[model samples]
Target: MASVAFGYLPILLFLLVALGLSTAFVVLPMIVSRFTGAHQPNPEKLSEYECGFPAFEDSRAQFDVRFYLVAILFIVFDLEAAFLFPWAVSLDSTGWAGWTGMMVFLAELGLGLAYAWKKGALEWE
Candidate 1:
């Protein structure tokens, strides 16, 4: 049992080192900046800068929800590609069952996309 557990020692050590390095990189700069950086704030510096001009309109402009819908649609389809890779790699091992499973998954995705398309989610207007 101890020997089995010891087998993971290198992985554990590598993970610890990776975490330590990542933490040091993130925290060291902030710590150094705390001492070396200037600490002064004014309304001019705090005010929003837009296109090298002062704000003429309300910053919180209402945008169409279609932009977000398009983004979400892209993500849903993009994740389909991610799922395809493992399915393709294990195609032979999984045999007909795997093929059928992937078909069903793809069919579900197709149905969802079709539903979205029908609802004008894909339309710009």
Candidate 2:
């Protein structure tokens, strides 16, 4: 029981150090800014800046479907890239099975891209 408890000491120490560093990172910047007199709040400073443009229309205005389609496509492909990194890193252990799986995943993404292209989803105008 004593040896088992000791084995977790390193993990506990790591968690403590991580917690300390994270807390410092969050709190230190606010402390430094306050001491440096940069925490002042003014109307212009606190005002919202929408892409450097003033609010010209209703905030609840509906957007084009193409905008959402493009956004979804971007997220899908981004997730595919994220998965590829981990799969590639573990390729040695995963072997032929992993390679075939990744190939199939890529093929499906490619087909989706082709379908989107055919429907002019990639077009901006």
Name the candidate that leads on TM-score. 2
- Which residue pairs clash within candidate 2? none
For candidate 1, write residues 47-103 as lDDT tens digits.
777677677778698778999899999999999999999999999899999999999
Measured on C-alpha atoms, candidate 2 has an lDDT of: 0.97
91, model 1: CA deviation in Å?
0.5
TM-score between model 2 and native: 0.66
Root-mean-square deviation of Cα positions for candidate 1 versus the true structure, in angstroms:
7.2
Worst 10 residues of 2 by lDDT: 46-55
lDDT of 1 at 95: 99
Off by over 4 Å in 1: 1-61
Global local distance difference test of model 1: 0.91
TM-score per candidate, chains pooled: 0.56, 0.66
